[model samples]
Target: MRKRRTAYLSGLLALTVLSGCGSSGHSSKPSASPTAAVSWKFTTLDLGIPDKVLKAPVTGKVPDDKTLHVGVTLKVSDEAWKKFGHGKSPAQRAGDVGKDLGITDAQLQKVQAYLNQAHIQAKTSKTRTSVTFDVKAGQAAKLLRTSFVTHKLNGRTYFTPDPNHPPQIPEQIKPYILAVTGLESYSVAPKARALGASAPGRALPTRAGRCIQRFPQKFASSQRVAAAYGFNQLWGQGWRGENMTVNLVEMDGYDRNDVANYVACTGAHIQLGNVNLGATEPAVGAEATLDIQMLAGLAPNLRIVDYQEDPELLNSGNGADSWAALNNALQRIIDDNADKKRPGSIVSISMGGPEGFLSQPIMQAIDQSLRILTATEQMSVFISSGDCGAFADRQYGSLDVSFPASSPYAVSVGGTRLDLAPNGARTGEVVWSDRSSLSRCENQWGSGGGVSKVFQRPSYQQAPGADNRYAASGGRQVPDISAAAINLPIYFRGNWVSSGGTSAAAPIWAAGMALVNQGLLARAHIFCYGPDTFYHALSAGAANRPYTDVVAGNNLYYPATAGFDLSTGLGSPNLPAFFNTLAANPG
Candidate 1:
């Protein structure tokens, strides 16, 4: 018989506390014995006060403003846990905790009273399991500070490198902290798991080949735009983004067979390079596969470089390590471009995390990398605006924007939904659902868009519609351009998968950039600005250009209007006419 493991609440709590107290590691609760089972529950709160107050005020100046927004986590005791669980997994146990906690009553009242006694006004309270309430700014700080001075709240401990400031974590409760906050860092076991349970066999190239035929029709509007820009005619003269190199940054790795199928279907000869950034296992994962497939289908001749970074190293939630990987990849691209003396190279990043979650150092690193690309005079970076709407799903709501995309120095791509006639002609078009808005997720498809709380409006964005008054003070305008994202069909595996996200939009734009790079190279103008400059030149070229303004459809948050709006940006690019104007003005 197998040896039975003894379980005690104290021992289990100790293990859990040790595991979760640190910023890293998998979240696990104490295992229950056969006599009594242990489980965890998750919840969220509103914390009615503004984030600026709960957090240290900006600029090291403590504001006299006495407001605080505090969200608290309360662990359910063993008895409560048992009562909540009729015998189910932790995921299933979640549903019961909401009711037992009187999540609608008692917990909420407790939160309100705490704030009221602290002289903090309670704006609102949303109680799930963990309750969030807003109070006067600095109230949280006051409570934390006073707790220390009075030598009370001994069970509460804060963690950080600095003595003066650190985030407080209530003692002996791992489940509550994990549920309410983001993870700092983590490491997975050495053994790799198969990508998924169902591994389908590779099939012949029918779907891939069909994608080639369907491409022109599916993107007829974009093709029309390209024709208006003179891309089709330019390609007629043998300039089709043939020799340029494009790199895609993504999590997980791609399927090798799928990539080959896509290449075969598109009739495009592309080189693929996979760089594992210290992943213990293979780099082929879901995200990687999607990016490679889309990029290859769009620009067949462009060399594809896959840079893989360990998910654990960057903190399991896809934060810091992503920035590190991006910087390192850019450096590698720059070095390679110099080695080959290639005139132009474009980097495409489809993966990103919510802003404000990143440390200042990471943001600086991004700025430095962009400066390098700009200074080298031969490189441009393209980043996805994010699939989550402007606020990144409210949980991280703090006037924050998605980074690298929000960085003023880089070209940020938004999304649009396309409608095609039976023959693939443009029947209709609208702002992609992925555009940043509160309703994005509700629609099941949305692109991340919103004003940036961190970056300021750049000179280019100071156009007629670029007024800052429309946004919260200190916020930056976003989504310089838009492309088809909603319900876009791609050849995945043996069948076609209709997927819509900013993930689809970024590569589509990246492919367009690749075509532009080829055109620039052919015209002997290797070091040029991004598509924005190209579009501006095209807009000035001729009134009768092939470009069509998207005036219908909304991102469900913002409407798509005549010219430029946050929804569709400057509308999808007219590739043909765009190329023509570039040839005309080889600046």
Candidate 2:
């Protein structure tokens, strides 16, 4: 999977490109029989779009000629899901496994034919259980029997298939199809879980003196980061994330010059690459910069790939075209890896919104897609839990968790406020929360963590340390782990900034996972890709100093406790010790 050595870019770029991105899924049993094949009529699956969204003011109909890209989630048989036990899949490549678990060849052919009859183009995804296509609005509306209408809600404008009218498919194909998404033409805007000054490509002073003088004790230097997280131990042991790649999911692009400058500034050795799924923003955003810079700083020798998505799909002025970009980007990662084009088993996604905000079909499609990565591809995915603590949606008196983060297969990362001595020894750490500084309804920023309103607790999460108070909720607990999220150093745009939040915390876990995989590959001849390895390691007791449990803080609502709690989950990593445990067991 090695590429020709190119000129060193930013340390973050080089390291990030080498460190791959993450994946997800957990069997949510499908009702469709594996052997059933019958001719039928037409129906619609409840998409679960909120009534508030449905009631929004309709601006107008989407242009008939506008192209809309949609994702179709097919049913997976119970027998296929049974094959994937609690830990891993028997299939070596995720793409090949889909035929058994996802859509059969006959099913794909029938669905494609049906869509073709409507002048719509569609094809099955290599990663399985999904079909994607782009079709003109008029054709899509005619086929689904719904008009696409623009709506303005809460100061934001977007569009969807007429909420009053459900999208329908032929009865013969309904059994094979779970849900068809992208008809909404917009995603609940993803919040980048970070806090800092952001200037995409603006020029600013490169000197560290300015930032250091301004932030004082707030920012941690690269050296401090290494010392704080026990990365020094891994580096001394020759495990600096070499022979590893990390994939970063982003909505924007970064400046190579900025990467190069950061690399030079931090003396980080990193290489970077990009794969654009659709039309992306011209300049970089702080979220993308933070992810790259943090990965570059921690795993300097790792390779990073930034998977950017379409900007127009998310922009305010227009929003009725391509809402499936995130799913497209994720599926692309699985396809690329399965094909050995860019084989990265590690992934990090720092963007997400409340789980409740996404339609049920969209949420299911995303979770099921993630299942392919974690169960089939055996990849590790780290997602920022969110930056708004228990109030994930940021609406007062509401408790929630971020989607994808709440997905069972993903390793949800929360945030912590850490105190380190001059020598980089941890003095103390607490759950990150700005409860006192801001209003409860608007600015109560902190690490996102809570009981999921969706997704049952995966088997791995049923371990002894888990919090069962929310057991009746039947949802997975968020933030399986956490890391310091405050005052982490990042070189963004053209200046050094003190960045923090779960956005900054997620990459730390991703970089650390890269090192863990590197070490495991050397000894076990395999990489620990799924959450099984992490849960196993944490369950190992004192044998592995898995995490430094945070028992002293809260994310506004949930308080950190002795073991696993809603806030901060399993606490911050114990680092090299955790790595050593995984290397020895390689579960």
Candidate 3:
């Protein structure tokens, strides 16, 4: 096992190095120092295309022509940073830089002038230090080529890097650029293969559907456990999350048809709203489809708001911009909800990069946003703990954790592999494994959990498994909850498909929360429950609930346990009974 772990870690490191090599060229020098003369990055969206044009590509059709988007990374000199009084704090410094850039009202005017002079129509812009402008589809390439030409704005020559002499981005910013652009793994296309016979057949079961199938049976059993625990029961009749709205953040966009089909399969009447943060370009894979479908499946009645950040804006490779996009989305949701006075809003994010690879400033920004959303909106955010385990790389034997989920304010959802009887009853469940093995029985990708090095235990996590001693001893509890994320067959685009990951678990938990919210409303409660209360309620009924304690599983790097192990968290949901309990308690 030790040898295998070393190999896995080595492989993960190699993968990261290779991934870096494939994209922008690697550099040892810091990309852009806050003190650099031309230090700043900006993102713009391509939006002149009609809605019809946007939807066509999503339907698997090619566009009449190619559309290019240029996300520019800029840097200000150190002297400029001092003149602008950009502070040491990431948020403050970024804010200061944004004020210098077009992120402020004054700057916005200058930016608007520039766009007007260029005959460009700027759609919407996000206000992180990096300001993003949405432009026309085909126009971006031209803008990229010419916009960098020194242009006069606000009586000063706002030096735009000549397209012929584009500004160089520091090596560190590359990964972030890859993440925001949704192009990190763009070099790899979907490897198409036929579905195996053992895979779930077409037409799966819905919570309300009558045609019971094996998959439904298993789901039903899980639901029944929640119901038995009085947790999964329906709340007020006619309450379809009318009072609540949810925001789902993901790296790519999904197949809308597949999402609609999944909803039909589940007999859910949920309405999904798509908000394109990125340009109208479709993400290259299934990440979007799976995330949206799972979220809808779990929370059938809530208003599902989907926000897609401009992939090009992210391609600038600045981690701060990614956080800015996330913050922008959250702020947008908050503003929208406030305008409508909708309480109990929630945001579910299923995407994350490795912890060590991210910059401290960016991490701080993320942490601050999480705290703000949790406090002001009373919004419960869910993040996938990770598909990797404690020793993230079993091949190389390194103990590392995934991020965003590690952020104290967000609830981390873990994964589990489930075994079902012929009748759809769950026979057992274990950690989803994704470790490479010679036997090749199952790939060992399991739940990501454990302690944090950077984050101290928050007050809410002061339960049996959470404490200073444990955290000090490198034992922070992860994945406050669990869901079936291993090899589950879900209906997508009128077909049943099998998929699994911490990605699946995050949305599943979010859907469960939607149901709980319904129950809370039924009982005349208005206050949103905190993570502590939710977990306490879950812990109270763990034994009597329909949970199948995963005793015999491993993430390839670590062994699974009977209860409350990091490998599977608190175990998969007893969906039905859990809802019932929420309805009864209404807290």
- The prediction achieving the highest lDDT against the true structure is 2
Which candidate wins on TM-score? 2
Q: Report the C-alpha lDDT of model 1 over 107-176, residue by residue, as the tens digit.
A: 3444444334455442221113333334333555553332111111223221111123443432313333
Model 2 lDDT tens row, 94-196: 4455565677777776776666566564556664687877778898898888888988887877787787787777777778877678777445766666676
User: TM-scores of all models?
Assistant: 0.61, 0.86, 0.60
Q: What is the C-alpha lDDT of each candidate?
A: 0.48, 0.71, 0.48
Q: In model 2, how large is the Cα lDDT of residue 345? A: 57
Prediction 2 global C-alpha lDDT: 0.71
Once model 2 is optimally superposed onto the true structure by TM-score, how far is the C-alpha of residue 176 displaced, in angstroms? 1.6
Ranking by TM-score: 2, 1, 3
TM-score for candidate 1: 0.61
Per-candidate alpha-carbon RMSD to the true structure: 20.9, 6.7, 15.1
Higher-scoring candidate on TM-score, 1 or 3: 1
Candidate 3 lDDT (Cα, 0 to 1): 0.48
